[model samples]
Target: MKVSRLVALLIRRSPFRAMMLAALIAVCSVVFSLVSELSRVSTEGLDAAIFQDNGYLGTYSVSLAGVPLTIEDQFDVVDRAAESLDMSVWRYSEVLPEVESECPPFDQVGRRSLQVMWERPGVPAELDFGHIEGVNAEWCIDGQSIPKDALFAPSSDEEAIYGAQLYIDPAYANLVALSTTDPITYGFYVVSGREDDQVDALRFAVLDEVASLAEASGYAPSVVIGRVDSAEVNVRDAADGIALVYDLIRWGVLLLAGLALMTVQMLSARQRGWFQGLLIALGAGRARVVALVALDTAIVAVAGLVLAVITLGALSDPVASFAEQSLQVQARSLSATSLVPLGFGIASVAAIAAVGPALMVVRRDPLAVLEAPRD
Candidate 1:
């Protein structure tokens, strides 16, 4: 018989069995796909947050003595060293103390720390303050035209910005009484003790778009440099932990589903023993019988896969939300990239479950099968 006709006959004779097989496959596929997607989302979210907050995936700290390096000298050293390194330079800065006078009173400063952040002309506004401790400022690209109310100098001081985290010693925390809402400012004092001579302390900002020339310049000891790069290794490492748990759960579900599919296929094959025997009497080859059985399995598996894709798409939002809440990270959306494993999982389950019944019927003598009573 033609493949289409054979499939139709099988469906007509065992619609419920086919449905059960399909349901099993669909459930397994959905579970695996959801787990994979959730892992991707959680890992990516963590990676992004970490990179954004720190400006670099890795941090290099340099201890400064009481005499701080001049911001110009530090930048020159960093810029030169970054030029020769293999890594991408995103942002670089020196964490420095701001004069108490340049900032607001300790009580009003709240929990916010006052450290200068270096700014660039075309950096994204959202990323301009990507969770480094600081209040939002009306940023100006033109250094020369800063508003009078702006605490930062407009021209050569363009790179200066404040941090949100007010780093205070535990003993001084009560003195500052820094609440989350406090407005904080950081100022610098001039060597001559003239307030007007005060220059904003230098904090550095480097973009990943730049090459690491400074690191190669041999001035590594003069400053602390932080580097952020698009590294998926950390995210993948995080996902591996989650993936292990999901894999175990998926295997258990697959085992149960496989058993159900196997039982149904075997029973159906047994019940149609006479049919099998007659087919053997008709000179149907073993290969033909095997093909027929395999076809049936494929049909069920494909049905399940289709149903799963539909179900997952429909439930993506809820699945994403659950994953985000459980993982405590942003959830990722379903995409074509996640479908490959889903398809493989469903196919594997269907193929494995079909083997026992297919082999049993295929190997049986046609006359014996025909003589056997239907189950």
Candidate 2:
């Protein structure tokens, strides 16, 4: 029989069977796409949130003489360690509180010591005050560089450290009668400088702010700040979890669908007993029958793949948006890696479904098939 005629006969006689095969392949493709895209988004977002919040891909902290060492000291220690380890130093720092300002009060406060503290409880008491530190541009996390504009300039040399005190909660702000205009400051007595200038200087600067400079030196934080890194890690981990679960579900659905498709194919071939017997008697080999079945399956699989691609493209925005809101993190677009797996999975399912029935038909004896009833 001609290949075209065989295809036409299969399609006309088994339209529902063909549809079932196509639907299964399409579903497989969609599942693959979703899992791939979700995983990529989760991993990338996780890395970003971790790095941003912790100031390093990974963080570790060390204690020195029971007087918790500053991030700068940690960096120095790590740098020395890296040298021994044959690694290059990127940046280093030790914590030192520099004055943030000695200028006209942003708000008129009559007292010299207002006793400001960080609104968030449990932050190191010493760091609670408006102490600032000098940092490299790359190390700065939150603020833009202090412009040459006078409004942001430090009034004295002591205040040259660039930093910002974490903002107080609104409830606390109300309690202190501190309007947004009030110049809230944290206070930290100057400790020994880290390979820098005078420790006795009482001056202050406006650009002082907190930052992470030690990660560049190959050290992580001892404790993450505000659970920033933890949150990101959790989000990505959740995505991976979802992917695993969905993969199992996809396989289960495919198994059921495959069985149904295989059954239909076998029944249809049995109904063509006379034709199959004629082909066998005329010297048609089992290999030829197998090849024909494979071709039919391949065609259905291709159609399913095409349909799956279209469906996923249509759902991309909604999926991304849902992920972003649900994960509470940024979701990146689907990647090439994601698409490859999905396409392969769909093709595999199609081939498996088609081959099962084809093999069963090949096993039947030609004379018996010819003598069998058409139904």
Candidate 3:
């Protein structure tokens, strides 16, 4: 059949009907697209919430030879572990041997007393710790636990002993000059920011690396990895529940949108029963008629998809703004990968919906179709 003839038939069938189908497709397409994007955003939000509410997940304590690993040692171990895992590892260490009385509380020194226990000595200068929060710092280890931005700056001449608190803590001035020639680091926590799916694998991998390091250092069976407490489990469960809700919503919306689109296409084809019969009676082959019906549906489907793409492009900024303000997640921009699902979904529904209508038109004899009531 010629393209011109197919178009004429479409025009005769009422452009409004085609327009309506296209509009439905466009709307459904956009709905699913937004749902997909929102799924990703909601996931990100959930991850953020989990990290905030479940601090235990990100922080792990380590002990070597029955002794709490020092921040200096922790850095070496974590650096090696990070290289092995090809991921980042954070340090949040507590200053060794809390001395509240001998050291005279940080407040007496006229400095803001941070209750930070972990002292990350010799942390990489280039490493950014901006994502971490709620690191409590103490007078003895004021600038170690906080993010890199508030990190203590030591002069080039003192860089060799910078991690030793040789200059930062006046209280530790004597310790640096006397019994402790090296930097003092006590108990610390190791943190890793990984996706939910990778948590278990990464945890085991880190433990393995820690164990390997322990064995090499002759501290075998003496290194202990921290376990998540009941409170941490509860928080993790809540975060998981939020993720489950998002999954249900995303799939539910897609399912409904698909059903609506299929129904519309079926009804549209069934409504054109008279026109189909007329074409057949006028000597149009059943194959030609079926092809035309399929082509018609395809045209509408394609138009709707294009319209949806245009509409989504125009609304991207507004949607992103709303997502940021209401959802508190950085909205991901649309990409070709993201559009793939939408395309496949629309195409699948259109093909399936067209099947029923095409079968109905093909099975009936032209004479019977013409004689039968329009209803």
Candidate 4:
């Protein structure tokens, strides 16, 4: 019989064992996949509630909704800052709504005006806004019924490192893009006042000043002071936790897969000692016997991995939904890239599991088995 058919026949010898092995593979695959996706969502989902690069401790944002037409007039309102308070500014000019969106925390920083153009989706998220950091305004979707399919920024992928790029789309609405050139935008003001009460008083004082200017200038100012979400709300700060999870997944999969496959294969090989002796006596080289044994284990490993992948595909969506609702994240993607490591891990474990069985079958003497009494 061909090695392939022979291997298949051998596996069929123990239906109960095969069933047990299949179950193990499926369960582990589901757990590993779900945990990984949850981790990604947890990290990415948080930013919509809070922003990165808060300018200074106790800093808060002051956004002016009804922006003046000319840049100089806009400057006039902010020129009246109290001597004790330090301030920085960024202006919004274009607000091409991706769907239904709100401002980002970084958009509150000042940058050089871009002498640029937007040819319909020209920029990838707040890209038109130059590099500036340390703002106090944090955005939240608390009350807004953000659509289920809304696309979000600070992408869940590796691209999140650079704070500039924003994923732009008209899916539903998760994030808003603000550039210095955007006309209907807020004036991001950085002001110092850590405590809520202190910031509230400062904001009220500014609003009062703007109201006073409105009476004299004939143009009423519309402004609101917003607070940046504090460190308490930040989720990414728990770097150690994420690292621990990754380590657990890696080690756990390796140890479980290796030991389980090795246990089964070694037991089967030791039981078939007389059969192995017959093959050797039939002129099959020790190396050939070992190769055949390794091939048998390889088939089992492939079967386990295949079962795992199929189960993952069937269940990823439901699992993602549960996670999304429970965790409240904007995204939960099961990227294909995550599988690369898993595949390698399985192969490594299978190879280690196959070795003991192959070595035992190869090293045993064919003549001794015939002379020995049957157990």
Candidate 5:
């Protein structure tokens, strides 16, 4: 008999059994999809820690050997070091005193309120500020409260602003003009290079430059440097624990599904023995009967996979919302690559499950099975 025809006969005769097998496979696929999505989210978080916001892999601090350096001098030295080493650097000031602004909270800022001076190579120093979105207030500068209207009122060149009050969204306050000449003993620096493999060599190069600059200034400064990834290693270790748990859940599901498939196939074979025996007696080869059983299993697996795809598509929004609220990361969508494991697992289970039933049918004597008294 043709494979398709045999598959149709099996389903037509045992629609409920076929449905149960398909349902099992569908549940397995959904569980696998969720595991894949969570794995992707954890990977994203790891990447964020590995490469910080400005793309730097390591942070270094600089200080003089029992001496103080002006902020401008420290900035120039680091800037020159970055240029010479072909690296990128970011400068952050210790959180400065927050000034009153009219900008709404969470508008130009994130969940927390902060004010800091931020500088990067090739960029001017600027104020970084965040505030509560709903609260409104006038610009208070140097203890002077000024209305927005008077602050922007027309003025002559002689009345030019020593400092101007900026009004903008809290999330986008980077363009605001700010500069300081305060002296400091140490400077903070975040560095990034093109190749990760050269990080250690690059660190040595940066330290050499710092020493050279200090020598040029007739003072040797103590350069302090540390790898940022040390702390991140702890985070990666935690992710590993989470990944182990995910694996346990995934494999547990696959094992149960495989056992269920095997049980169903074995029981169905016993129930349909007379029909298979009759088919063999009607001139169907033993191998053909076995192939038909395997094909029926394959068809059910395919139907279950199709149902799983539809279910995942319908649940995408809810999954994303859950990920965002609980995991604090966006959920990844289903990809062909992600489904590869599910397809392979289903194929493997079907092949293994079909074996026992096919053997039972092919090994039995067709004459005896057909001539036996009805049970």
Candidate 6:
């Protein structure tokens, strides 16, 4: 029988089973490809957040190596680094509980208050909010000091900011024109998530750079870097998570590809023994006979791969967009280069599986198989 005819018959024997395996392969391919692309993009954005120590609000904690927090001595270096890295340096408000600062509490600052929508009046608002919407509610700070509490509708007016001590994001800091040394305390904690990890490395690099700069500037200063309770994430944790997930996916899909396709192919091969025996009887070489099976497997694999590619195209954007919104980071476009290895691997497995049964078929005797005299 011709190779094309054999392949057609092989497929016709169990079309749905073949299609089901193909679909499974496609689902695996799409998932792996999408995850790989997301990881690459997430890594890129997170790397900058780790090194620069500002922007991307989800960053659990930022590590500053050296140069001291809120110190005017290293302002030049900090400024230069900020310029070079194209990053904004954030200064934490020193107004912690029981700490007195000359630079008025955020409550004393120009109109910083919380606004929210309530069905009725007199719903006691929580003094401190875990949500940003708390910025709109009226709260009594300290004793008998309800700083400018008014029941007005939510408007985009600047008067909404009626509180005294808000976390000094870059914009708020700039608006106040506060000096770094004006008791406007900055908290530059060394984030050592993993000992000797990337996060630690970034912190060390910062320390080294500042030390070198201080020495060069003819100032051998005593600088101490300490840790604070900042409940933020380090980039290394994310990397570990991605690696663990990838490993799980790779093994799971490999098992599916092997068991599903290989088993189906083996069952189908049983029905084609007469056809294969005919080929060998008609002077077809073992290599040629095996090629026929490989070609048939290739056809199925190609179909699966195409389905996978199409599914990936359809899902990648939506998944990426969801991640970007959910995680609050830039979800870059999927990279084409990531698929090369995956495609090659799928093809290799299909070829190997096809050749397994072909080897058996090529050695069988056509006339004896047809006679069925021996079990």
Best by TM-score: 3
TM-score of every prediction relative to native: 0.54, 0.50, 0.58, 0.52, 0.53, 0.48
Q: Identify the leading candidate in terms of lDDT.
A: 5
Question: RMSD to the native, candidate 4?
Answer: 15.6
Candidate 6 yields a Cα-based lDDT of 0.52
Per-residue lDDT of 1-375 in model 3, one digit per residue for the tens?
Answer: 684587567756688877887888888778777777877776666665554445435444544443346556656665565456554445443333222212333335442212122344533233222211333333333322222343343333332222223112223333322333343433334554432333454446656656755666666444445532113566567767876776676556555655665676567667777877888899887878778767777787888889989998888898889878986766754668778888887777668656766787789788887898875
Tens-digit lDDT track of model 1 for 36-136:
76556655665455444432343333222222345454444435433434222233333332323223233244332333333322231222222222443
Scored by CA lDDT, what does every candidate get?
0.51, 0.47, 0.57, 0.55, 0.61, 0.52
What is the clash count for each candidate, in the order shown? Answer: 41, 28, 7, 9, 9, 23
Per-residue lDDT for 1-375 in model 4, tens only? 456665677778877776676666556655666666665665444443334433233545555544343534444454344223554333222334323224454234333222212222223233313122332333333334322222233433322222233322332222233322244342344445333334566466566656755666677677676554354423434544665676587558666877887888899888878877887898877777777778887776677778878877777677667766876554433458768766777778778888889888867988998678878
lDDT leaderboard ranking: 5, 3, 4, 6, 1, 2
User: What's the distance in Å from true for residue 374, model 6?
Assistant: 12
Query: On a 0 to 100 scale, what is the lDDT of residue 358 in model 3?
Result: 75
Off by over 4 Å in 6: 12-14, 41-238, 332-334, 362-368, 373-375
Q: Tens digits of per-residue lDDT for model 2 on 1-375?
A: 776568768777778877877877777667656665555565566545434443332222222222234534433443444344333232212222222322233223223222323212233223222222231111111222221111121222322131222222222333333222443322222222122232112111100111133234444333211111122445545656765776676566555656666666667666666676767777887777766677777777787777877887788687778866887655533456666666666656666677766776578788887777765
TM-score of 4: 0.52
Winner by TM-score between candidate 3 and candidate 1: 3
Model 5, residue pairs in steric clash: 104-133, 105-131, 105-132, 105-133, 108-169, 108-170, 108-171, 109-170, 109-171
User: After best superposition, candidate 2 residue 30: deviation in angstroms?
Assistant: 2.8
Return whichever of 5 and 6 wins on lDDT: 5
